[model samples]
Target: MTTICVDVMGADKEPAVLLEGVAQALAADTDLEVLVAGAAEFVEPFAASHDRARALVTTEVITMSEHPAQAVRAKKDASIVRAAAAVRAGEADGLFSAGSTGAVLTAATFGVGRLKGIKRPALSLPFPGISGRPTVFLDMGANADVRPDVIVQFAQMGRAYARAVLGVAEPRVGLLCNGSEETKGSEMALAYHEALAAADCGFAGNAEGTDILAGTFDVIVADGFTGNVALKSIEGTGKFVLKRLKAAMGASLKNKIGMALLAGSLKSLAGELSGDEYGGAVLLGLRAPVLKGHGATSARAVCQGTLAAVRVVRAGLTEKIADACELSA
Candidate 1:
């Protein structure tokens, strides 16, 4: 059985909505055990309503609205910290949280630590590109700035993520830059581009923001600042398109017919492309896989994120990342 710890105190909706996800997951997978970290009394009612939720949940609720670090340090009972402890104690295979991004990151970093030789871990996001090919972008928001050597490590880790998660044979890596020209943008990007090329990597040269949407490379490497911008842009675009499509469908009789005929396909396609649907962004270059879901996640999103965590661990992503980094104890 796969065990997962969920931060119930995290997210905008609190434990109620989160319990829905836990219930849904438990009902779907008998082999899944959920460790809920929140107020146990609040969760008991929800658990009682569902048979599987009652049977599968191992109640362990942490308090709400406390500073994550201090709470983790002082309370030792905060939901996010307890979840991390669950992972550290080998009681849970992975931890999922939609809580304070800072708190979750801090607690996990302190509890799990980074893989050896990794300066700091990065968050890697995989976007479905043109032709359904997935491209990975790294350092989404872990560290705002990075050194040239760290950028190289990001590239290697991003490539490994693509290979394991996306099943690419030899993922092509590209440095995200302002322009494809060699002498474009800041000294940081140009210097890092040169470093990536020099390293023993399948560097595909430089790629611009435009190329990312056009599916230019298998992996996109950038510092957290630029990478976060690119990730938000893609997410914003998806939302805009979906909204416009819905409005168009409601405007006319012909459009209604078109929607009726294509609704199933559209739903499936949307499910495949959504960030929430794809589960969560992973904090890569760590000893264990850590998935960070949206703060406003739904039960479906949580379930998906848990499934993604299971797949990442089962695929041996951590070992592959350590091998790619060539770290020595």
Candidate 2:
């Protein structure tokens, strides 16, 4: 059975709401077991009611405002900290948390540990694209600054993610830059371009911001700073477009008729764009998969995130990543 340690605290939503998601996940995946970590009051009752779930009582909770490294160090009994320890100690195959991104990353990196030879673990998420396939993008917010060699490994990690999770065979990789031209971008991008082109991983060349969702590449790698900015920009632009569309649709009775006809398509598009589809971002290059959902995630998102973690464990994602890194080494 695939067991995932779920940290049910630290999210904006109530623990009960996240527990509802755990219940949903358990109902959906009969082969899955969950180690729900949280305060005694919150987890005990829920675990008692669920057959596949067991409670790991935790006393402390990591707040979003606290320094991630310091909080992890001070709060040994914190829910997220304990959850990571469970994964490290073989009590769980993976971990899922909708908590502070920094806390989850810090705890998982230090507690669950990085895979041998991995310089850094990257935060990766599958971006839904126009081509009916999701593009695996990495370094979403792991390392703000990275060297060319690190970027190359990010490319390899992204490729492994695309293949293992997205089921893409021979996934093409791209370096995100200001322009598609080989000569465009800062010295770092140029260095990345040179390294990726020479690396054994599939190198599809430089990808512009537009190519992120244009279905031009299966995987895109960037320094965490740039990747995080690009991700937020895409999300902001999507929201802006949707808001404008809603306004336009409500502007006139004629538009209402048009909206009625397009309602199904629009809903489908919204679902695809919603970050909930993939549950959350996976921290790649770690010894075990660590998924971090949005801080304000809903129960449905939590359920999806739990299932996504299960998928990662079942696919032997970390093993594949280790092999890829070793081969490249």
lDDT of 1 at 263: 81
TM-score of 1: 0.85
List residue ranges in candidate 2 displaced over 4 A. 253-268, 327-329
Best by TM-score: 2
Segments of candidate 1 deviating more than 4 angstroms: 27-30, 42-75, 244-274
Q: In model 2, which residue pairs have backbone atoms overlapping below 3 Å? A: none
- Measured against the true structure, the TM-scores of the candidates, in listed sequence, are 0.85, 0.95
Please name the candidate that would achieve the greatest lDDT relative to the true structure: 2
lDDT of each: 0.76, 0.92
Separately for all candidates shown, the number of backbone clashes (residues 3 or more apart, or on different chains) is: 2, 0
